[model samples]
Target chain A: MTVRDPFAMTALDAVRAFRARERSAVEITRSALDRVARHDRAVGAFLRVDAEGALAAAATLDARLAAGDAMTDRPLAGAVVAVKDVLATRGLRTTCASRMLEHYVPPYDAWTVARLRDAGAVIVGKTNMDEFAMGSSTENSAFHPTRNPWDLTRTPGGSSGGSAAAVAARFAHAALGTDTGGSVRQPAALTGIVGLKPTYGRVSRYGLVAFASSLDVVSPFAQTVADAALLYESIAGPDAHDATSVDRPVERADLSRGASVLKGLRVGVPREYFGDGLDADVSAGLRRALDQMAAAGAELVELSMPHTSHAVATYYVLAPAEASSNLARFDGVRYGLRADGRDLRSLYGATRDRGFGPEVKRRILLGTFALSAGYFDAFYGRAQKVRTLIARDFTEAFAKVDVLATPTSPTVAFKLGERTADPLAMYLADVCTLPASLVGVPALSLPVGLGASGLPVGLQLIAPAFEEARLLTVAHGVEELLGRLSLPSLD
Target chain B: MAIDVTPARVRATADLARLDLRDDEVGPFAGQLQKILDHIAALEALDVSAVAPTSHVLDLACPLREDAPAPGVLRDEAMAQAPRSEQGAFVVPQFVDE
Candidate 1:
């Protein structure tokens, strides 16, 4: 165990060190905390750090280990995991990066948070994100936009930008992020980390502040596929608290048990995704990735998901519609910030107006209009119907291939204020990622290579629902072929 | 055809969403909503009447748990974060004006 900078070790390596008794839990936790202190000022990844709690948890784990407890029961034993602020952590302030809940602390742990605790993992902090997880860039966060570690001027790509940046900057072993219309994968792509958005029902959503209920999914961001899979294993399964969680038993992913090669695997290339707006360098990088997979014996089949074009329009409708209903709970009367007015209705309006950011307000109004009695069928109804077709497109493609391959985003991380002015242009950032979210499939983003702009380009591999194991394994195979990327210099 | 989102319609939708908007916001919101609606109008071109609407892609029913009582966040604790509350209940502005 010749580890000098413990922060640089991959999460899996850190786990191995812990099991070997080479590194004490406190040492690892302290290293992670130290790194956050050093880099988080520039990164802005964390909204709140639970330093004392993390140390206490580490001390307890060390005590258990000293008592000759093998600690084999906890797969993620001693790993430091940062959670996105949207999850409700018992007695810990969970702001969801919105002023509405800036001072609100939940009375109970979210299902995934409890699972992480049970797995002997240390909760490092709550990360920053788009307020209410409504925007594509972290710029919409009420506090401040998290800068990309790769380039100080660029955004990390959000609303999971903070989590992605934390992992990329090595602020923690790994972090949990939620993906509603590509929040996790897109940021992972931009930050040059591995992000996995499991099938919708794969991970329990209990205690996760609902964004777009049906589309929202809890995901993990890590330096490697195996590390992400480890975090995935700890938090995924059936939870009685979350009715949407699948009833199936949890199966820990076995990355090594699967075939080492991508031989004979059918990989689909969606022709519609290769259309206009994809950067030339990103396209070239994706082609090179496809070629690499072919060399590894994976067969590439070009297919058309004609409804891919409709995904953005469909998602904007369905997601905001759900968000409107979900956000209605945040009125002045209940928990969260309140503004008193002459009447209840005026109070509701005043509180929301004061609480929500512009992007959240925009989406709420869009959703209210979509679900309005006069326009429901034309907007929300049509979008849902189109959503079905989008899912059907995936079903048809999966029938012909094992997984679909595409570039995670059209371009690398754009400048911080580049698309802030144009909501439509900002929405276009999710153009490639929304289709899979609409279809309810498992998707993984791996760093393929850097692009012409000298920023990272990510290759997205998507599998059918509940086929997370297959998705991760294939992603692992790809990651192995591509090798690890160099860490971004803090300069 | 692009649906027109006039300032009146925007004001009405804002009211429906329970959002308080300023005079300056109404014009911009209407204009922005119109642009998005114009983009979303592409969905209208496709004939999806034959397709069933999927609110959620998963085909699973809302599985009901056993009718068992479990310890929930205590009243005092839950009320601790409430902006305004009465005795063991959330306090709101006057709903009925006598």
Candidate 2:
């Protein structure tokens, strides 16, 4: 029950303890970097380490504390946070874990990154991700695949695997990731941590490299719900920089007083998520958590999201369609890698062929074909309508329940290299997490317990769009009932 | 009806994407793309004529900015990123038709 290692402390507690002078920012930042240094060669959580920048920030916080600055406005003062490679971090290389942007340092910070600095969070380093946030596992990273810290043989589900691994491995207090589909939650579920995908446009995407434009969401990874809320608060808000950024005011549940109790809470258990393809460990774990919630005065209502089976198919079409258009800007005329050719068209082809990885190429082609002449209505257009039907399913389900609950991933972290050979198999990894993304609802995966393989199982809670506060509050109630999840050793 | 995923089709799509896919990539990409296409065929059975396509989930119109000059990346910074830069511009391969 006692945590002596300051690195193991959650971001919220660490910030408070550091502010109270119980620990120094420099020490916590140092502990964070030190842990990454020790285990990252095995985990590959961070693509690049910004030790010098992080240390300088930590030193500044130390000086302010020494000068007796209360740092009243900066709630995250002295906290170590990891930025995903996909975000544009000024002066630091924002690779997106693709060769195309391997050395492309952005001229400006992502709005979320700027806000993190404004709130006094040290930018630890850029975490690894699937190239263009396109894959379910970190294997698609043009860089090395990130290993699951829980079990090295397995993957830490991705495209945000590196972010999730960093938090689970105690390398960072919390890490920012983009969830185009299940990048944040799936990885968090597999790695044994907490991840929240804010409602679409909940957080600004000013400097986040575009993936699937409509589906992409900037999200967070933390070891605890309180820490997730704190991180979400630091970054979530309106930004004029991004036109899609919603102007809605942020409303976070007060996690201070153990506020959200399970009493009278109506949780909908989708029957579709519990059917075939549901792994035994995930099924057992979810059932156990629901029973605990029911015992603690929460009501579980069985509901059917009829269009659930079509989520993966619909997302693949719509996401790639958007990605094809969004990624068209990567021609040789811009930043990132370029390969010369005899003419304009040849140059573009050469550069793209040399720069992009396989998954990115596949998605671009799939998207292109979907939106191409004659096939548009059959593929891209049809997917969009099915997307509407899927969203309507949630709208109807929510009328009878507070939040929809399900498993984050169908199973625990599968063996690395297991599904890398099959694109169809990899697409199914996000099946449970895709419906929320397609509908633009706020959803999160809370660490429940270790499954049969001694790996983590996450219970997903999804709320209506712009209902992040309710989502987090209900998740907090579940977290309270489940208690702090004990993590696996790196050994 | 499932569209035939042929090597010719893969090449055609790649050309549209300006991908310049390698010769070896054609067959594999075709097979993989076909598998995905088959899976997505599940959507074809449902009649969605009554449903409106949702391009963006929120249904918010694009917030237009005034048509005025706004500050962006400096010329020097922008030029620095180009692989082939000339007198303050990007240099592209000449495409004078034969």
Best by DockQ: 1
DockQ for all models:
0.84, 0.81
Q: In model 2, how large is the Cα lDDT of residue B48?
A: 96
lDDT of 2 by residue, A1-491 (tens): 33468776888878888887888889888888878888899999999999999999999999998998898888899688998999999889999999998879788899999999999999899999899998888998998999999899998999998999999998988999999889999999999899999999889999999998888889999999988998898899999888889888899875643424678889899999988897899999999999998988888999899999999999999999999999999998868899988889999999999999999999999999999999999998899999999999999999999988999999889999999899999998789999999999999999889888788999999999998888887888789888878775575
Question: Going through the candidates in order, what is the number of backbone clashes in each?
Answer: 0, 0
What is the lDDT for A257 in model 1? 38
What's the TM for chain B in candidate 2?
0.86
Per-model chain A TM: 0.98, 0.98
TM-score, cand. 1 vs. native: 0.98
Which tens-of-lDDT digit does each residue in A1-491 have in candidate 1?
A: 67877777888888888888889889999988988998899889999999999999999998999999998988787689999999999989999899999999899999999999999999999999999888877999999899999998999999999999999898888999999999999999999999999999989999999999898999999999999999898889999888889977656566773335588999999999999899887899999999988988899999999899899999999999999999999897778999889988999999999999888989999999999997899999899899989988998999999999999999998999999988999997799999999888999999998888889999999999888888888888888887888878574
Q: What share of the true interface contacts does each candidate keep?
A: 0.91, 0.86
Per-residue error for A467 in candidate 2, Å, reads 1.0
Clashing pairs in 2: none
